[model samples]
Target: MYDIRKLVQEIDKEHYLNELEAKSKKSKKDIQQKMDKINKQIEVLKTRKKKFINMLADEKIKHDEYLEMVEDNNNELAQLVEKKNEMLSMLESEQVIDNIDKLKQELLQFLNFNELTPAILHHPINRIDVKEGGTRVINYRFAAPTFE
Candidate 1:
């Protein structure tokens, strides 16, 4: 069975890429606010794991109880790490690359270089093609740009 939620989320990838660009232009405080929220979640996970370890260190706790605490904390930490990695990879994938390429093309259009011919800009000296007597001759008399 096809899951509709997964399909919707796939469509949202483009929206998320745009959000990344907007965030880049946003205020530093706004950016840090969202980043701090993520850091808080990570800190909470670490603190919970620390408590699990501390609880297990008590001499009164039974061996099975200690093992259970350690196992639960380890599982939670593993899940968090996996989720973070998945998000990171999604942000780094080919869809984002294509989105960035499109954005660059748009920006280059604004730069007025999008329509320039490569042949005119590529050579230091402009050489007019000459074909005489079925032979080609190189002309180096063309004036090129100079910097003082």
Candidate 2:
């Protein structure tokens, strides 16, 4: 059965996370920081957005003022939201995705390790080389043979 792909997947998933935690504190720290930052930015944008809506409902506001305020708030919110998404995408890379898949396969290989651990014995291409100079190829059974 095919297994190399599975082995890589398992290593990436079950092993890679733990390994990453040990290997790169900065990456982990950066992720936590980004998450907190994104959340705070989102709240701020929501509040600003709500205020813009409230302004529209105010009876005293002129049409030009309403449009200008709405446009400004929209621009700010869009910028903040875009920054959050960019950070998230940066943190999530193709390597990590591939590793997760590889880890799954490795886990499966580990579970059925007894079979994988066993060595395979195949007959050698060259059976024996004589010192003076005859070259012989191996035949699994002794009874076989014609000289090439």
Candidate 3:
């Protein structure tokens, strides 16, 4: 059996840290972009809602129609708000980004003992596939590095 821990031990800490930080930054930017888009959509809906209210007040739209439009707008707004909150919560989470040193240490310890503990294995190895001709394919939990 291949000692999977050796792979972790061989990683260059600085390179791994750089890759992790880059990934984190990209993820944060993507989430922020989505949130900004949602905010813009919400603003547009609010404007439409305001217009509907004005129309109703001026006796241009019937009461039932106004109520239905308002209800629809409220439901849509609620959904967008919920999605925005979820994105915000994700952006606020720093657990993965803050634990690089700890993770490195743990990986080193696991490698030193050459033990395949469930926690250690599951933390880094996503899966292993056995192929024909005794070939085994390994997949990592994080983005795999490309060797030059």
Candidate 4:
């Protein structure tokens, strides 16, 4: 459990982050495909219910049979909708890897300075110009960090 190799992909944080993003994208695609399939199934059930109604109107099927078939169709639709809800929940809960570059920069800052302070914020700046509309202009020092 304490093994770093087990926790990350090949001991490279950038590579690990990229791999996570790729896996997340693939999982989203798979869930989207499954939801598409469920949507198709729901459409078919709806079409079947319409046909059931048409059969009753045409006197080809009895009222009782039409009701039974419609009930069964609705039940199947409900089940599929439940499945779709589950997939949606999974999609919402799925971990997405975004802003990897920003993450890497933060991680590097953490590695360089374990604790954050006002001094750290002011270290690589010439001056900060505050503007009127919730905007600020930042001036950088000649020795400002380039993150190279």
TM-scores for all candidates? 0.39, 0.45, 0.62, 0.62
lDDT digits (tens) for residues 17-126 of candidate 2: 56654544566568769878878977886787677668778855777887888788778778877887776776774244335544454445445554433332232122
Worst 10 residues of 2 by lDDT: 139-148
Residue 38's lDDT in candidate 3: 98
Clash pairs (backbone) in predicted model 3: none
Candidate 3: where is the Cα deviation over 4 Å?
1-12, 105-148
Between 3 and 4, whose lDDT is larger? Answer: 3
lDDT of each: 0.51, 0.55, 0.77, 0.70
lDDT of 4 at 130: 92
Which candidate comes out best when scored by lDDT?
3
Better of 1 and 4 by lDDT: 4
Off by over 4 Å in 2: 1-20, 94-148
CA shift of 97, model 2, Å: 12
- Backbone collision count in every prediction? 0, 14, 0, 0
Which digits, one per residue and each the tens of the lDDT, describe model 3 over residues 1-148? Answer: 2444544644546676677678778878999999999999999999999999999999999999999999999999999999999999988873456665665666666566566687865766778899999898878655333433
lDDT of 4 at 143: 20
Local error of candidate 2 at 90, Å? Answer: 2.1
Query: What TM-score quantifies how close candidate 2 is to the native fold?
Result: 0.45
